[model samples]
Target: MNQKLNIAICSYRSATFGGGQGIFVFELSKALNHLGHHVDVISGPPYPKLENNIQLIKSPGLDLFSTFNFKERLKIFLGKKNKSSDDWYEFISALFGGFPELKTFGNRAKTLLDESSYDIVIDNQSLSYGMINIQKNLPLIEIIHHPITKDYQYDIQFSKGVIQKISKWRWFSFLKMQKKVSQNLKVISTPSHNSKNDIAKDFGVLEKNISVIPNGIDHASFTPILDIRRVPAQIITTASADVPLKGLDFTLYAVARLKEDFPQLKLVIIGASRPGGHTERLIKRLQIDQNILYRSNLTRHEIAVEYAKSNVAIVSSLYEGFGFPAGEAMSCAIPLIATDVASIPEITQSYAELIPAKNSNAIELAIRKIFASPETYQLRAEAGRTHIIQNFDWQKIAKLYEDLIYKTIDEFQC
Candidate 1:
């Protein structure tokens, strides 16, 4: 064990209930804290809910855009107090970038780093130039959840029209800045080998400069609920339906094709589609509305219950830097049917049934094949649970991170 040290973890979002990044920062910090280390999570709009004893440093964004309405908006504004120079810069970037809400994050980053003091500053994909300023004050380590370029390439390949392509291009314009930051920063960490290769190839960073730390799961929070019994033939997938990289729309397509043979086949999507949104329209067009279910705004507990009830869980992503859903489902002892996409195969390590992504026939066939062999589900489910526990559990991940952080700190001293 190492001496306890003051640490700061920063990210654009902190509401662990929302995305994987939030969940990562929240749980990882908590796990570190539990190990008798001092952890302070500095985050932006949609702030994280840390444990009562833990320190939560809120770096609020303007939140110019959100899925919520007036009352929720009021709460966000009313909750914020401090602002910083990075906030102003991020604001300018977002304004010019055409996504007004993004300005809030840019600004928050500037604000948080402008007056930084910590033993180590671990940035959770808040790859703003503001971080460069923090590096000037103390050792800074970045956790690139995955390379953003994969998402960009996936978008360019699957986009429907010129306008969509252009919009995605603008959204990803920040990656250039991120890549530059990575080159300058000495210490970096990513979740999986898939990400390690992508970072090296796309960002031009050396493999030695980056550390590999698997994403951790909270066995207590995500443990199975006794009542969530295995439904005879049910499947669950997570992510925004509009994103082609998620490849969930293809999963739904496979479901529609399989429904004729297995009328009771149910595909539960743990995310919603926008009206006139890519996913909603796809579902409407495919005419599988009756067999599919959509859920969003679920707490980790609720999601675990949903996972516990399903016969199998699927990761329909075309690319994953590190597959959180796949890992989480495996933690819950659910049989996984994941695609042979970026980094996913690395995480699953042949413990899962892998299929090629974007192929509806293959996805449908895999799902049906699993249905045909009920005995394999329990065996695979048990194997996945054991695998995740041994490898990706938070305690093990935290220890690895602790080693990397101290190593980076020592090197900086030299």
Candidate 2:
């Protein structure tokens, strides 16, 4: 066993219900702690729900996105004592429609981390200038879960007009800082080969400097419930309906097309759709409102049960650094149909029925094939469960991280 080292993990925002980053931080910290390391998660607003043993150090910034009320934001911004320049910069930048949380969080994180003693600092995708400064002073390993440039590209591709494209560009303006900061980092980590390559291309980082350590799934929580009978013609997918990058719109279109053959077909989305949003309008336009259900704020057990009740799971992401929903579905032993996009293929291996992304016809055909041969698909689903248990389990993942951390510390000391 390696020497037990104190570790600090930094995240800009880590709301468990928020998105992939939050879940990653929460789960990874838990696994690291289970391996006998003393881990502390330092995060900004919308703090992560960590286990009792893990310490959480709050380093909040402006938290502009927390509320829409301008007056409330002003009060919080002005009323806070000993506010750093980073706080003012975050508020002012966000006030003008730029995402500055990464920079602000990085600035605050450097000061907080400098005061603490740790073997290594793990920056969980908060690619900011301050991270570069911290790396110069400490042993730092940055996780770049694919570059934000991909999101910007997808948004630009899906924009309705020139004005919307410009708006999208402005909202993602922080990519410039991320790209610049990433270049100087000594060591970087990513979840998949796809992400590693994308990061190299988009962030201009050397491929040799990046390490691939796949994320793990909690098999105990996501395993299949034997008592639940699978509902025929029911499909499950996790997505943010309003986000074009999630490809929920494509999934909705595919579900509409599938209804022509299987009229009893229903799609259950494990995510929320914004009221009066693009997804809401599309659901109305397709007339598939009656055939679909949206669910959110579900516990892991509840999500596993949802998987147990469904006949098929779909990952409709246009791109993913690592698809958590796909992994969760596989852990539950559900037949998965995922698009051959980004890291889905790398994660699912040969277990899933692959389809081309952004193509409704391909999605429809794949679903029809699965329904036609339920027994075969069921066997494949079981294989998926086995694959996850054998390869993507948290214990195995944590060991890999442990090895990497030890190796990094050794090389740094020499």
lDDT of each prediction vs. the true structure? 0.78, 0.89
- So what's the TM-score on candidate 2? 0.97
Highest-lDDT candidate: 2
How do the residues 18-53 of candidate 2 rate in per-residue lDDT, one tens digit apiece? 678888998889999999999999999888889999
- Indicate the residue-level lDDT of 288 in model 2: 97
Which regions in candidate 1 have their CA more than 4 angstroms from the true location? 67-116
Superposed Cα deviation of residue 392, candidate 2 (Å) = 0.4
lDDT measured at residue 245 in model 1 versus the true structure, 0 to 100: 84
| TM-scores for every candidate against the unseen true structure | 0.91, 0.97
Least lDDT summed over 10 consecutive residues: which range in candidate 2? 60-69
What is the clash count for each candidate, in the order shown? 5, 0
- Misplaced by over 4 Å in model 2 are 69-72
